[model samples]
Structure formats: structure tokens, C-alpha cells
Target: MNTLLEQLKNKRLVWQANQQNAIANTDSTGYQELDVALHGGFPQQGVIDIDSAVGIGEIRLLLPALRARQQQTQRQLVFIAAPMQINGEMFAQAGLSLEHILIIQPETPEHALWSAEQCLKSGCCHSVLLWHQQLEVAQAKRLQLAAEQGDALHLLFRHKRQLSMSLPVNLAMKLSPHAQGLSVQITKRKGGWPDNPFQVDMTKAWPTLTRVRHADNVIQLPQSKVS
Candidate 1:
């Protein structure tokens, strides 16, 4: 089977446990503080998870990067969602033309993950976004590693309560949808903590992600230990 979880013959999967932790992605979420905390956004080869109690700011956080990708590549966004019934016009209004986004519907998480793995590894598309409620740790790990292998950025959206410690996600943040704006919780970081957690208010007019301070890129990381 051409599984997304393809095992490298030279490098055994078990060896991954011993390999040092690596950051997955770091593109701008458009939120400077959040991106700083995330050491960019998500790891370069990342399996970023958006665990949302409510998905208000989550959509806004994603829009900037998605739009940037579309703008840079002039290609469609490969979006796979069973429950993500986002209006195409809403995205288009936010700067992404509806025609520039490709929407695919898969039957289940396995199929969705498999499809995302294939698409990402294929090197034909720009990025992939998926929402799956019942994703397992093993499957997530496979996706994480697969995404890294594919050199693709993947956003895994799960319910807030589902964010746990077992998964090796590059970054895991919790989202709270609110009446006025969205509340984000940068719940987990790998090597060290970001300067601070983020609390971004969703902007309405267009694709804008304002930050705590000026939207600067550099973030002072934790002091490395030298022994």
C-alpha cells in the first residue's frame, strides 16, 4: 500500500524516538506573538494542531498564511473538511478567490489523512488543511512524519478537549470562539516556551492578524543549556 505512513528502509521508524525534536513549521499565522511562541508558526515539516473549543480566531489565523500561499503560488488551496462548511465567498472576501481554493471531501479520517498525505507528498499542491475529530496518536505521528517527508505544511483541527500530551505535534494550541473575537491558547511548545501566550481579537474587514506588539518576526528563544 502507498501509505502516507511510508517507512524509510534506511532509517527505521523506531529510530525516530531517539532523534532530537525538530520544529515543524513557522510561517506567519499573521499573529506575531503566536508566531513567536510557535517559533515561526508551525514547524517547517509540521503537524500543527488547532484544538478549538470554538473556532473563531482559528479561521482568521489560518487565512493570512493560506492567502499568502495562494498569492505566492497562484494555485488553489487544497482544503479537505467533512464539517468545515466555510462559505467560499467569505474566504474570497478575505482576499482568497474562491476559484483559487480546491475543496475535497473524504469519507473518513483515515481516508482524509491518506489523501492529505498523498497530496502533500506528491509535491503538486501548496498546502493542506484538514479537520478530523477522531484522529489517533499513531495516525497523527504518521501524518507528522509524512508531512515532514513531503515538505508540506499541515493543520490538524481537533476539538479543544482532545488536545493531549501523547502526540508529537510541532505545536498544539487551543482555540476559544467568542461573541466578539477569538481567544487562543498556545498550550504546548517543544524546546521552550514562546515569550508569551497569545490572545488575538479576530479582525473583520479583511485578512489581518494584529499582534501584541508590532508584527515583528524575530523571537528571543529560551536560553540554550550548555554542558
Candidate 2:
């Protein structure tokens, strides 16, 4: 009986590996440097955890891909309990359609997690973004599995301090504001070596500098502010 169970487990592992290989697709992240680092772009289905200090250009870095997805599929992009209010006009200026974006403000972190998982599993949205600083490993795994099953893009934004704590994800990166633009450091990735931190000039996507203000070494701007 034990032997049979072991054989079944092995078969399941093999099936999962085959599925992963079959579904893997290379999508460009719109940033040449990041594309080379990630071997294309973000994974089509999995949890992508981004850790960054507040006011960094984390969301700005993803605008291009999000905009492309919005235009390509015409699917709604869902935001669950975002830490800051999204500026629709800013996203619009960046080429993302405000009509295609849906923002959800959950009352609690647990509610946000539950909503995110449900949104991913429902397959109603092309991508789901969740901002929660405190996420348990199990919760992260749940979100990852939900993303995989739904075949949707899932981006989790967390505080930089969470970098010390591990989370189950396909890709993990540390984002910071640099003089040139947004500095992206691949902290974790599957099936490839992480490269050195690279700069992505967000101004290319967003030429309007009305939002972000960098002065005296202090970043003062609204959420999703682009440099």
C-alpha cells in the first residue's frame, strides 16, 4: 500500500512538472533590461511578489505590461485593498484605460486576501493586484495556486521589510527609486540565475511629471507616482 501511494505521488509530481513546462510562455515586460533578466517578462500565471519602500515607482514599472494586457484582452484589471488610492487619470495618461481597471477596497487584510483569491480563481479578470503587508506563507501559497489554476497574472505588493520573510511565488523583486528611474533587483526567480539590479526609465512610458516630486532626498507623492 505504501509503495502504491509513493508511485501515485511520483506520478502527480511528473504531471505537475509537465503542466508547468507546457503552460510556460515568454511575455516581454516592455523593459529590455528586465526582459533579458526575466528571460522574457513576467510569468503568465503565478504569484509575482514585489517588495519596495513606500513612494517607489513599483506600480509605474508595471504600467506598460498592464496597459498592454488591458488593450489586448479587454479584460478588467482588479485591485484588492490597495494601500493607496489609485489615480485613474495618471493611469490613463500612462495608456491604461480607466474603464478596464477595477478597484476593491476590502475592510481587512484577511478580506483582501480572500477577495484576491476569489478574483483570480473566478477568471473574470486578466490580472489581480493585491497590497497587503502581512501575508502568511500559507496564504501566499493559496494565492499562487489560485493564480496558476486561473491562468491569470497576480502581483502582490508588500513592504520592503517583508523581504526578510519568505513567500511562495514564481518571481520576487525588490524595487527602489534610483536617479535614473526605478531600480529593480530580482530577489527570487524560478529556473534562472538572478541578474544585477537594473534601471527602468519609467519616464518613457509616462512623460508627464506632474505627480512625483523628488526633493531633499525625500519622495513626496501620491500612490502609483511615477518619476
List residue ranges in candidate 1 displaced over 4 A: 1-25, 163-165, 194-197, 204-227
| Deviation (Å) of 97 in candidate 1 | 3.5
In candidate 1, position 14 carries an lDDT of 27
Q: In angstroms, how far off is 224's CA in candidate 2?
A: 46
lDDT of each: 0.66, 0.79
The C-alpha local distance difference test score for the whole of candidate 1 amounts to 0.66
> Model 1: which ten-residue window has the lowest total lDDT?
8-17
Q: Give lDDT tens digits, candidate 1, residues 109-162.
A: 678889887767766566778887777778877887777777777787778444
Provide the lowest-lDDT 10-residue window in model 2: 14-23
RMSD of 2: 9.3
Model 2 C-alpha lDDT per residue in residues 11-53, reported as the tens digit of each score:
4321232343322575678888888778778888788988887
Best model number under lDDT: 2
Superposition TM-score, candidate 2 onto the true structure: 0.79
